[model samples]
Target: MKLLVLFSLFFVLCSVESLKVLVLFHMPVKSLSILGTGVVRHLLNAGHEVTYVTVYPLKNPPTKNFRQIDISKNVELVANDETLTMGYVLEHQIEKNGAYQIQVFSQENARQTFQNENLKKLIQDPNEHFDVVFSDLLESEVYSGLAVLYDCPMIWLYSMGAHWQVLRLIDHGTNPAFTPDYLSPNDLPLSLFERVEELWARIRWQFLKTFITQPEERKIYEETFGPLLAQRGRTLPDYEEVMYNASLIFANEHHAIRDRPATPQNFKYVGGFHIEDPVQPLPKHFQDLIENSKHGVIYFSMGSFLKSNSLPKKLVQELLNMFGQLKQTVIWKFETTLPDVPKNVHIVHWAPQPSILAHPNVKIFITHGGLLSSMEAIHFGVPIIGVPVFFDQFTNINKAVINGYALRVNLNYDLPKGLSAAIDVMLNDDRYSKKVKEMSAIYHDSLTKPGDEIVHWVEHVVRTRGARHLRSPAFNVPLYQRLYLDVLAIILAAVYLVKYIIASFDTKKAKKQSQKKKN
Candidate 1:
């Protein structure tokens, strides 16, 4: 009886020591989102103990062993935050510029969703030693302390919408958005002006990084986390260490979307992670309508958050006019009722997006260039015409154009005729269809399902103490240190001393020679 009790005690202790991970994604969850769904699935399947936290509630509850931590529960939302207005406006403009320069000194296009209060709640717990962390890079500073508190490796995931900072932060390259010279998709050799653009962007990003990552910010954060460390019997890690110690930098996208090289060793591309549930059945009425329609279908949607009807009155009118001109049936995912509806146009507040995309007769998708929508179009072998309003929509369209799978039209009043022309080109031409079909095959191959890859990696991190081998050593090396300016400084000082001494000796010799001649 004593032996059996001792063995049972031993097993319980073993379980506690096994791999533990904390996956933090402080973003709003949208319907059929792969980040929210796929991450939970992967972490659970990997057998690593996982905990998820967010700024807001998830649409679908967490599955498997993952527990969703409603961060609002622990931290109070600012009762009256004056900063809210500036913050929101700044975020919008930042998205527009495809770059962010905060206060003209600190600048990068990473998400800042982590409120100060969120950091406090994470550290208040004395005993939290996660083996590794998988964190969304946006507002990653929130987990800066958590990474240290656990004394573990971290994997930084990129925004589902790719940006230039992904290369800059994880791989130590310049932001490609600002420095398009180095990245030419058209296969054209860059001009001298383009070369200057690349060089200036590199210089600008370096300056921005130096300005933003300050000693003061680190000091304040350490001060906050120090108390938590004291309780746990651990010392605090430096800010540089906290930032660089991540194991792998993954993204919420697949390489098919953007397959750029990482200039540094630490970044790995395991994207296409926006996994969604299987296609759901269409509602009875919608299904019946689709079945009865003789002509092929055309699906129109503006995505969530932004209402297509919210546009200027003329813009809405133009869209109706264009839809009325088309012979194909239109299923418009408009959130509100329009003043006049065409016979062929159907408006619904919401639609099962994946299902509508799956319909065989559905030819082209009109979207806001959302990542999910773009991915869906590619995944289902459908072509697209994007109307970019904001955010990654521009990049999405650019990539789609580069890939020959889609076209873009800005929200102009003239869009009725322009949209009609673009739509006619797509429907008449077979190239877009062939291109998207080719992309779809590559998007989902037999071996690497996005969900499985994410699971394998999440488990790899937990199993191998964050698989620290994947972390970038460049993060540990300071920017100045990376430039190797110490060596340069030494060389310059030596050269200057030599030049001064040589000149002095040469002058003295010349004077001596002159004196000798005069004597």
Candidate 2:
């Protein structure tokens, strides 16, 4: 009997010391994304084992001495009109559809590569089990169900800046409305139109999610996962409750960007997750150009994956002509060689961005407003001229403008004239630098460093065994209840009763007067 008890105790201790977590990222390795690496690194810090199911294969994954496996990257994207048309139908049905559109689109691609059944089997096997799960909430439904199958808590990581998706999963996939600032009670600071815009955008997004993106995902889920489950009888869980299983959510955005009213408890902002070696020295030529150029050096980079050389030759020529006129030397991060060279400009295939930003002579940055680029620019107290192309770049540029450190020139806008003026504004104005400095302080002065904040919370969850204590009870309360519908209903009921009483008295008075007149 003593031996049996000792054996049971020994197994429990082993499991606690060796907790496994599975992280799924469905983007390219060079994409220099923020979420995948940050979460994996911190989980390891807390003594939790990690398995990063990479979407794309690498000749070498970034980290050393860590477990990394490339899941098939054959994700089927549902972006074309052919696929989007079906998603339009789903948008018409599901009333809650904020993240559904992108969620469905992105996840469908991943689903095609790795069948859902494989995920379940991985979870259910006794030898291979996870104590907790952390997933980017691009598609909460799929991962949330897996969390339920494992009977564990899930943590959501928002890849992009704060949007409605993170809130949806944290509210247990019930409210469908995402809180802008998880800490504010009122949506102050946003104009009435902006609030309305967010509402309409979410409503439209909800209906399109399942229909357009996951037109066939439901059937796929049942076919692959139904028979393998023990309690679910070979079926999927409720979409509304799928994310209630999440223990906490870690957002890449912070109160610096998303500080607004009516926020949620689940938002833990650990911005700058992709902060690479900030100390790497700049290349010698790049360093010399910035230091030697008599006028301040202006740096132009559109970020990785998008090549500046791919632009029309006409556009390239226009840029080349503009560089010849500038007193400052221009360093364009270009993929291909330029036909005409100007003494004032230099072109390189790749430039260490942070190193250049830190350089004393770099005066202005031209960017696509990717968060990392924008943040680095601000970190150095430099202003930006943004030409946002697509995706969250638009949102990032919009916020930078709102915060007053940057100006956006639309990609489709007349580039030569518009860009020249934007550059002039950054150069002439001292206010932009002052504004960036203010933002830098706010971004850096939070109670905890973003990385440390992330590590602390991750440890908090593990220590508490998924920490339900941190959850907010607001989701269980319905909208009408939140808005005091019962009180309003009572007031409305009383108004009708008073009207009825007044009408009864008037009718009696008219009948008695008529009787007296006849007599």
1-519 in candidate 2: lDDT tens per residue?
999999999998786665677776654423433457766766666566787765544445546435765554433352234322212322243222335555655566546534534444454464655667767655435656556555666777775555555565555332223343221122335566656666666566656754665445555554544554644454566544564567787766656664333446666767765555354787787777778888799999988745675466776788788777888888899989888778888888888888898887888899977767877776676789988654566667767887888888866425767788888878889788788878877777767666667767766786787787777787677868888999899999999889999989998999999999999
Q: What is the TM-score of each candidate against the true structure?
A: 0.79, 0.79
Kindly give the stretch of ten consecutive residues in candidate 2 with the minimal lDDT sum.
Answer: 82-91
- Candidate 2, which segments miss by more than 4 Å at Cα? 1-18, 28-34, 45-47, 62-65, 75-104, 116-126, 171-198, 210-225, 231-237, 501-519
Every model: Cα RMSD to truth: 6.0, 7.3
lDDT of 1 by residue, 362-430 (tens): 888998777778878987888999876655566677678878899887655566777898899988998
Model 2 TM-score? Answer: 0.79
Best prediction by lDDT: 2
lDDT of 1 at 334: 78
Residue 402 error, candidate 1, Å: 1.2
User: How many collisions per candidate?
Assistant: 5, 18
Model 1 pairs in collision: 34-275, 111-139, 253-271, 253-272, 254-272
